[model samples]
Target: MKKVTLKKNLSAAMISLLALSSFGGTVHGESKTGINADAAILVNAETGKIVDKYNEDQPLGVASMTKMMTEYLVLEAIDKGKIEWTDTYKISDKVYQLANAPGLSNVPLRAGDAYTIKELYEAMVIKSGNGAAIALSEAVAGSEGEFVKRMNAKAAQLGMEHYKFVNSSGLSNYDMLGMHPEGTGVNDENMVSAEDMATLAYRLIKDYPEVLKTSGTNYKYFRKGTDEEYLMKNTNALLKDRAYSYKGADGLKTGTTPFAGSTFTGTAERDGVRYITVILDAKDQYGQPSSAERFIQAAKMLDYGFTQYETVQYTLDDTETKDALPVQDGKEAEVKITVDKPIKVRMMKKEIKQAGVELKLDKDKTGEDGKLQAPVEKGEKIGELVLKNEKEAEYILDGLQRDQKVNVYASSTVEKANWFVRSARNIGEFLKDIFG
Candidate 1:
């Protein structure tokens, strides 16, 4: 087995991909955000910026949605040299049992079958196969219980509020071991909020965009060296066979269970911008006995996010703050610094506004009062550049309430001087300032 550290959600884990500010990112105002599902949320794929939401914080069965995290961990392991795409694992009695278990979603993993990691991953994500999910979890973490522990830990690390996992497959209301043997009665519904689902989707797409390549799949898959196969129709109706299909719609996962109702974490791209939306406990809005309320709502929400909002990229002036600040007791009286990276924020384009930037420094760097004192080195972190809304007195980004803080470093080295020389330089600077 290979060891891999799970990452927080992409916004939190992939700093290079999405540099969420410390105050988070500042939005001037809220957008129209309401959904019909029991819970739902729409977010920008790049920024993890929420455009709108409703009951997104309410916990409920995530069903096969749990497989998203499962896939994340598996891919994470493979990416870190822990496992290979072709690595294979033998089917345990548990997985085989799940295949034969009536009414449970599975890809028919017969006993004595050796399945490759990639094959099992597809079954879990594309088919929502419970057996394949357990097989992958056990292979990676040694046991389903241990695998679930990693899931919860990763969820918490991703800043999922009050989320919990009982099983890797999100099979709820069933005995934990009923399918495999070592069983107990644990109502592990795989609880998660719609907002968390959006976060999870954002990270998966941000860090593993490749996952979308398979989201369009709607078919029955076969295990390696096995003659048996099951029709693996994608649960996401928008992907195919529906009136809700939209341009740039691609891959994502859907989960449904007796208790979970119908839930989906969907993604699509339009005009160079991608959007992810989550709908939990969806309804049959059109009155079709099998109406795909999930897909309909998902399409509506995703469309709203894409057409109503846009991600803005702003670069700091060519230089870091562009001006050198006085440094006490340094050979050079002042030092310059540069912006570490450009700022990317999600905002509405209706009435665009330039994001406000505030440069903050450590008191010590500023000597005692708000001035810098030192032998500051080039590339040393002196402070951070914060992004704020011009209307901060009235608004904020809906979900990410914190301001964004980018690390600012000293651009040049400034060495300390002899006390006499330093004192003389300070006096001259003071006298010059006074005269000016």
Candidate 2:
């Protein structure tokens, strides 16, 4: 297996195919965003831009939503050849008991019977099975205790600011029935802020998109054709045919615990844009815990994202780059530069028309006088040109203008000037200085 490195961000073009082909590119009117939740956030998955947010940074229990990180590590291990989907793990008595425990979300695991990693992964993702999660954790890291360490390490590596992973599953230690990972408090539950949840979701999709194949399924049978056959339905209610089904809704996780309430991380694609949303500890209008409440909150945010934003090609306008760079001792006195590639950004439809580009040249490539040295090659790297909207404030993470950026490159090669021509130019400059 090839090693996979975590990518900080993905280009919109990479997932553009998920967009609807029928979209006519018209921007929809903005809608009011009034979300009732302890914390909520809407993010443009491609650009990692925060579209709508409320109390996004407040850390709160994530309940089973914490399994997303577990899912990520399992996928990472597979990618790194540490494990295979075909690898089978024998069911231990502890895992079998946990799987059979009353009132917990789980699929039956027979003691002394071996189940493939793929089988357990499906159980964990589609059914939010606590037992399956612990089993997979042990398979990957030898024990839930060691796996919890890996979970926290991966969270820190991913830049999650407010988060703690006490166990492989998101269950509070009390829910673990004294089988919680060693060193964790009895009632400690997985905790994370809405913003960080979005980050984790984004990385999971970006890294192991194949996980969606299982998570998106409405239902599947575990241990099919056998006496132990059990049907596992995806917990993400927003999937097709579910009670709160929404178009383009697919793959993500839902969580609920006495402490966490109802929480969801949802994603949808439309018109060449995808948005990831998180609604944590949501309540219905009556301010009561309801499974449907998180879906409703997620729908509101998804609706706002789909209707209020537009993805369009961001190119250098015809009049933006007429200026040329002076080249010292080159065949030509100046070299023209242009954008190296096409850039796309998801922005509020109302603000698209107000966007402008700013050119930034690389200082290292040029001389003290801010001129390129001769022998410049066509398409040579120079610097990046940033797209900015004067009307918009930097609302996402700092330095992440979410502005479309493309490298600027030399449009044509400029050969070095001949010795005679160089001498004549130098002499002319010296004479002019003496005369002055």
Candidate 3:
């Protein structure tokens, strides 16, 4: 059997489903008690398909959510062998200034204190530490200015066009509190569109899956090496057993600032379908004391995704041929074609039948027996296959504006016959002409 690792998504806690009977129409129109956000989006993590979208293109200040990129770049540096888990970075005066700054989201760090890769990463991710973020930025690129450049470059590389990062920590330029480095050209808070935010989180999870190990941890301690330890609470309230405890919610990040209000990128998985929700600039709950508006909106969006749509995974087996084609002038009479690799197509269960899933052969390359000629190699291009419903196809062709033209491949190989085998065909042709 071919080796393929499929992590089951459903959990026992998900057994008690929240029957979103009231907020069903929130996706289409605004509700008084629905997701209170200026922009929001829920995406199918598997297919990159949008389930619910509201003003997702409008760029808004992302605040601490910027750490997602910060964390990603750190992990990427480690992956590239430029850094290591044991490597330590000393806290600089700039880092201490930010950490001690009034009202900044950061753990207290004294100047010259050193933190290892694992410790600082946990503080940055779980505590949303501005100090840790800036420290890592300096360690990675030698300066916050250079790190911000890399951040913007990485965003563009990931196709996140609607993103701008001016600082490692997502603090606004206006809210700098005179803590940024002298003559630093930083002039803006982090800005990101909902769609781009989800794309960033999706890419981060896909590329560095180990991020979940820290992002999912609910609590930890920073400065474990010293007595000045600070308790770090995972800012993502959706993951905790709170009023909006989403069963499968693991992480991403959350941000709240007076100007940005609240921002969040939450990730969850249920029944094989992974969901990512982005909410930016959410309304602060009127009279509610806690900073839970983002978490509530994230939970509502995730619940809507899980209940409104059912995902079906179609096993795209590339090893076995669902159909075979007869070969000509070859050692073998036929050749088998299939998908080139084991893949899964996750889509709305309702779209399965109407998805217009048709398996077509490369007719232009076929032989007289309606099959490709011999000498066909395994995994050779044969044709095209699309897992799409009418809406999906139109979305790609029109509004959603996706360009995906992929080719299907053959599953097996076939070799050509030698000269003696060609003589047999020549003899048959000669006999047929004589009889005629």
Top TM-score prediction, candidate number = 2
Error of 2 at 13 (Å): 46
Candidate 2 per-residue C-alpha lDDT over 1-436 given as tens digits, one digit per residue, 9 for 90 to 100: 1211111012122113212322111222322488888778888887778788877766677889999999999999999999999999998777888888998999988888999999999999999998999999999999899999999999888877777789887886776768888878775668788888999998898889887788899999999999989999899989999999999888799998767789999999876678899998898888876788899989999999998887756554623554477788899998888875666766678887887667767887777787678888998987777776634533334435444678888889999999999999999999999997
Candidates in order, TM-scores: namely 0.72, 0.84, 0.77
Of candidates 2 and 1, the better by lDDT? 2
Candidate 2, 409: how far from true, in Å?
1.3
Model 3, span 249-286: residue lDDT tens:
88889887654567889999877678899887776656
Q: Can you rank all candidates by lDDT, best first?
A: 2, 3, 1
Number of clashing pairs per prediction, in order: 14, 0, 0
> What is the model-wide C-alpha lDDT for candidate 1?
0.71
Q: Point out the worst 10-residue segment of candidate 2 by lDDT.
A: 1-10
Please give the CA lDDT of all the candidate structures: 0.71, 0.81, 0.72
Task: Evaluate residue 427 in candidate 3 and report its C-alpha lDDT on the 0 to 100 scale.
Answer: 96
Question: Sorted by TM-score, highest first, which candidate order results?
Answer: 2, 3, 1
